[model samples]
Target: MPVPHERTSKKKFYRSPGGAARVTYIRGKSGRHHCAYCGGLLHGVPHSKGVAGTRALSRSQRRPSALFAGKLCTRCRATAVEEAAKVKSGFKAAEAVELSLKPFVLEAMARVE
Candidate 1:
């Protein structure tokens, strides 16, 4: 890729009030996207593809494209998977505790009584 020539700013009027700054554009430059998880440059390539059939019976049951749809970048995604595996393997899955309004209702009933 060719480097763009150095840009020179235009002279501003002394008496005029400033509204917006001038926008500059290079001939061949385009916007680049970064990773969703790590905020690193994605460059030109996508996340890696793991060996086939590794997740054939996985509970998540999502396609590889769907799984990596968020563009997390391979390294960060790997680290996240490692952390999740550590948590999942070391501990049993806990049931979600439902929040109930029964306590508030009981308090109100007591106040009424």
Candidate 2:
């Protein structure tokens, strides 16, 4: 793949008021844009035609970011929160923890004669 040329600043977009920064992207022979993560095709991605020295927001871009409590999304966003909760032990002052059995706790008590 050709190193995407650093297009002129007039052809890029920056989150801030400044224009000194730049960004990068891929341009296929067919002139189709794709997602950087899954390579899925994208449309209306910000700054596809702006300057070259800034990070362009994808069509799916969300301000403040759902992971940081700025925004929200389905799927991975919720999963991230749950996983973060599980890893909370790392931040706890205690050196060790005792995780109780979940299924066993939920189980019904059988009749004991």
Candidate 3:
């Protein structure tokens, strides 16, 4: 029987040289990170086995350096920047921005210019 920590792990059987079957437990992998805005898979992010494995990585390896890198995809980031620029320049109203994009647009507006 597996220990309490490994109770949920998958089991595999292998034949040994002595003709005895050996069982091995395999732990499940963590899910990939997705973008908050586009629901696309995030790039440049490592999927570690658990919290300790993730903590072992450097900050740069854990997430990208770009603004909102881990949270938003490149395409959505670009759109947010464009919308923020238009809103800042009086071409678009803040209220007219899409509900999902409003927070991103506001954040970009404050940071860009």
Top candidate when judged by lDDT against the true structure:
3
Candidate order, TM-score descending:
3, 1, 2
* Alpha-carbon lDDT, every model: 0.42, 0.34, 0.89
What is the Cα-based lDDT of residue 105 in candidate 1?
27
Model 3 reaches what TM-score against the true structure? 0.78
Error of 1 at 64 (Å): 7.9
Q: Itemize residue pairs with steric clashes in candidate 3.
A: none
Compared with the true structure, model 1 gives a TM-score of 0.33
Residue pairs in clash, model 1: none
Per-residue lDDT tens digits for candidate 1, residues 53-78, read 33454534432343233355667555
Error of 1 at 63 (Å): 13
Q: Per-residue CA lDDT of candidate 3, range 1-113, in tens?
A: 55986678888899999999998888778899898888999999888558898889898888899988888989999999999999999999999999999999999999997
Across 1-113, the per-residue lDDT of candidate 2 in tens digits comes to: 44346352224344545756654354523334443323444443333344342235442552333332222223333443443444453543222322332211112111111
Question: For candidate 2, what is the TM-score?
Answer: 0.25
Model 2 error, position 23 (Å):
28
State the local distance difference test value for candidate 2. 0.34
Q: Which residue runs of candidate 2 sit more than 4 Å off their true CA positions? A: 1-47, 50-65, 68-73, 89-113
User: Estimated TM-score per prediction?
Assistant: 0.33, 0.25, 0.78
